[model samples]
Target: MIPDPSAPAPTVRRKPLLAVLLAPLFMALIAVSVINVALTAIGEGLGADSSGLQWVLSGYALAFGVLLVPAGRIGDATGRRRMLIIGIGIFTLGSLLSGLAPNVEVLNISRILQGVGSGLLNPQSVGLIQQHFRGQARARAFAALATTVAVATAVGPVIGGLLIQLLGPELGWRWMFLMNVPIGIAAIIGAFKLIPDDRVRTRTRPDLDPVGAGLLTLAILGIMLPFLERGASVLVWLSLPAGLIVLGLWWAWEQRYKRAGRPPMVDTAIFSQQAFRNGIVIISVYFLGATSIWIIVPLFLQMHLGHTALEASLMGLPSSIAAAFSSQLGGRHVLRLGRKMVIVGFGIAFVGLLCTTILAGFVDAGWVAFWWLAVPLTLMGLSQGLTISPNQTLTLNSVDPRFGGVAGGILQLGQRTGAAVGTAMIPGIIFSLTEGGHSWLEAFTIAMVIIMALTLVAMGVAFADRARETSAPGAL
Candidate 1:
């Protein structure tokens, strides 16, 4: 039988292809923050504490961070689209398991599985964008992607709140995970039909660095476990030293592996580019401020102001909307304005956060408080929108395409690691400061100071980037 030459190749128009490719990853971003409002309900339902709550959130982040480098490598070795499908499927399964989990331990385990899935898929999403799009198309796609992320981050809390309110505690929390089912299915279908397969040249089977993976995983776990178990003095003490030792060893092993011409968990050479190194630090600090806002703001609304979860989620709308719009705008100006966007972004975010800190002290059920919080949150969102996409583009652009996967993975690791640290530490800061004091206002002020201080540090990094850019071979 002759092969049918007339058969149509799968017709994926550019627009649909963008949607098909971006939607699942966008949903994944939504999943990251959706659980924030649900934490209390999840804890109550699963018989958890503050520590367990931290585990539920940080476990996914830590797992995702640890596995990102390897997962990116796998996508490169195999196929980006193929691995993405598999990863999304795994993530869907993990989400279901998490929703149905009978206890805190099971929920934490499920979250880790979800993180693994995120680890596998997250890098592929960015890789596909790099592979498939270029120039203006790439810029537009990134803007859209950023908007999706902003929307997801903004809407997740409200959706979770609604689900919790409508369905009540028992069934409501499950919907958070269950909600992924339809979205995941659509993404899978879209992948098979719409996403074009992009594979890299391979000469031999890529060697999996199991030892390095193990060490990295353990190191992250050690570092995160202490923060998760904030109230447990013994666990915190043990994890701190142990995490440091493992990290030191991992660094040593990576250096040795590089010398031996083996694939290190993270290629140290990327650090050679001043822009890439500084970009990663900036990304880290940006996430620290952003994630801390997400964590602390909701807690303040729910606990101090006695707002419902729904109300808290609603309070986040202004910021989310602003971020969605600003990300695209930032992309446009990146080429013209250069890296100064980073400084501009942080400066705006600093002012916003400072305003929020002040407003938080005087919060009440009125438009005054709402506007006060809304304005800053909106500016913060705008700042993030402006800073994040450009910083990511700059980081990846500065590196070789061959090592794009690893570099992207490292950037994402920095982001999630910062998030894990921020979420874990902020609560402890609030708790410690409020131990003997009944003034929630006092506690919030102190926390805001710490957060603002971090933002200032990030701003300094951005300024350093501009200085470095000026001194380099390229000139205005």
Candidate 2:
């Protein structure tokens, strides 16, 4: 029953294609922020500490970050359809495990499994978009992704909170992970039916470059472990230098591997593209600051102010909604406005964070502060809509379609890595300060300063990139 390789590919309808692609993305993106509202309940249910709860988030992100490049490369070399289906299956299983986990240790492991699954499928989606669409259509498709991200970020807390409220905290939190089961199952079926077979034809076997992948994985693990562990053991610090050394070796090996007429896990040459490089830096830094806001704010509302999970989640609801609409608008204008849109977006986001910090410092009344916070969150959402998708469009515009999977994987790696560090580091700072007798508001204010600083760093990078594009014209 071998199928003809030369048969004309079936026409892919746009809406179905988008639905299937975005569904999995929605699941993964929601996982990133949704759990913030549930962490307290999880800790109370499982008898875990701050560090254990942190691991639940950090472990997922770490596994997600490390697997991204290799999964992207493998998807490109193999069949993306198959890889995507497999990823969803794994993610679904992880969700089930997470729901059923008897203890914190098991929950962390299950979350890592979920991360691995997300890492596998995400690149494939990007590569598929790169392969199937061109020009404005491509921009719109990416906009769809950004919109999905926005909604997921916006609704995750609400959903988590609502579940906790309806079912009670203990049972509510478990359902958050469990809910993905049916959705993931549906996505896998839709993928098989709707996605066109897009395996590249090759005369020779695909080179997966396992050696290079191994080296890169070790390097990433070394670099990220210390940040996640947050000095739980002093020896973890040594891994930083060691990871850097391995990273250098991985780069050198990539050069040698390419010179030997084989594909490397990442084509080192991709980094030479200015737009892609700059986009990586900007997004990574942006995520470092941006992702923490969701985590810290929810925790502050719940733990410090004694707000309910549902109430804490509501704080960011307006922002998420704003982002969703703004993302669509940004997608339409991205090609026309270019990096200027991204720069402006970063500027607005920074202002939002700064303003939020000010309100937290001066306002002592809880309900009143929540109402006041909405304005800044809305501004932040608007900025997010402008920044994320537009930056993605600009960044990947130069990447070769053939390498789109790895390129997208690299792009998301920056995001996930930043998220991991930020989720761990920012909360770690606040928790540490609280332990040291600082008020939650004071600790939160200091963390906001750090987040704002990251936003500024991203803005600076965006400005520099804009300058590069202006000076060289075609440099990006």
Candidate 3:
């Protein structure tokens, strides 16, 4: 067979593309985790109470979650490159505001701005990878992303702790935000040059469906508000039902718009795709189970067990390292093994969780128990690397690249929602159990079981999806 000389060469340069895309992501993730270690300094510096400190975290989360789907829709309709640059710019400005904040209120508002910026760019990154990369390259790209997530999650505390120790509390926390300024500027410049502006223009204008967007905004705010403001007001629970109602209305409007031959904010039909649907289930459930470990473990080690903040962070570093390594390996293999990789990942994670629970339950609380916990935590991290990137690859494979931004947005929204619910419920369970006279280990054991149960649910979904693919031969 003769190769066609006229065919255009593959223009996608994987490494440069990934670097440009992942830089903003690294900055965003670090902001999320690093703030935990700096909360005390921030409160003291700003004269904030527990409630104000909570807002600094919650405001970021809320703004981040709310903007995801809308930003994705806009990016899909417009040019992703443009959106990515704008998002990074906004994030940089927010970081500047946060670093120089004179009051808790200003700091909380700046954090929300940062969240909005992160929310805007995240889907564009995923979409660009989907649009440019194919086959194994796509898997590797996602793996790289998973590695960034692992490294950022693991090192955030260490970086925060080191800064605070060397520079003292007042200036250290300020530097955490300020550090992103140069990085964000560089990323924005790279994004302008490296990110291809390849959005295909059509004669028919794309409809953004503002009405649908409005409904979704209401629904998301309603559903997420209760979780964010957990103890604020009993009236906050009303938002849950209100959110549900708005969600139903949004569904109806989307269906109606699609029937009328207009583009809805989200095409209701995407949910019908088995791969996309099941992938969302697995990722969301996995996040629900896995993300809480970073929260509860630190609390158990530092607040209850009286370890130094940096010491507690170091205990989790091994797991993060394992995750960072395995994610790249998992990316290489995901194309061959498919959903089996995720199933195996879940199985290993369950075992790790079981081991963690048993060890914590049996071993007395001290450095010894902490050391034992590291072994299982590393296993869990390895499992995570296998699960996350592979699941993302499998899920988005079915969607057309044109809708990649919207699809990625929706997928991340599910993940964020799951994390919110899980973090709220799982941590609350430990606190509630301990307050009710349960030992710290006992509380941790119960929470671990819940996490295991969530992981099992995700595994079950993966198995069912695998069986469906086998039975139908091309259903996925």
Pairs clashing within candidate 3: none
Cα lDDT of model 1 by residue, 1-476, tens digit: 32221121244366787787678777787778788778878878878888788778777877777778777767755567788898889888888898889999998999888888888888887776666665556666777887888899888878888888899987888899988878888889989888765544457766656677788778877876665554658846698789889988988888888899887766777788888889899988867756877777767777777767677677778888998888898777765666787788888888898888877766643446544677778888888887888787766767665555667787888887787678777767887777877477788788888889998998899888888777863621
lDDT digits (tens) for residues 1-476 of candidate 3: 32221121277566898899999999999999899899999988889999999989999999999888888888888778888998999999999999999999999999999999999999999888887788898899999999999999889999999999999999999999999999999999898777766554667676789999999989999999878875758789889998999999999999999999898989989998999999999999998879998888888877777778888788678998998898998999987888889999999999999988887755444436566778888998899899999999989988887788889999999999999888888999999999999988889989999999999999999999888777765543
TM-score of 2: 0.93
Candidate 2, overall lDDT? 0.87
Q: With candidate 1 superimposed using the best TM-score fit, by how many Å does residue 192's alpha carbon deviate from the native?
A: 2.2
Best by TM-score: 3
Clashing residue pairs in candidate 1 are none
In model 2, pairs of residues that clash are: none
Point to the candidate with the largest lDDT.
3
What is every candidate's alpha-carbon RMSD to the true fold?
A: 4.4, 2.9, 3.5
- Please provide TM-scores, in order, for all candidate models, with all chains considered together: 0.90, 0.93, 0.96
lDDT of each: 0.77, 0.87, 0.88
Best-first order by lDDT: 3, 2, 1
Residue 180, model 2, lDDT: 95
Q: Give the TM-score of candidate 1.
A: 0.90
lDDT of 1: 0.77
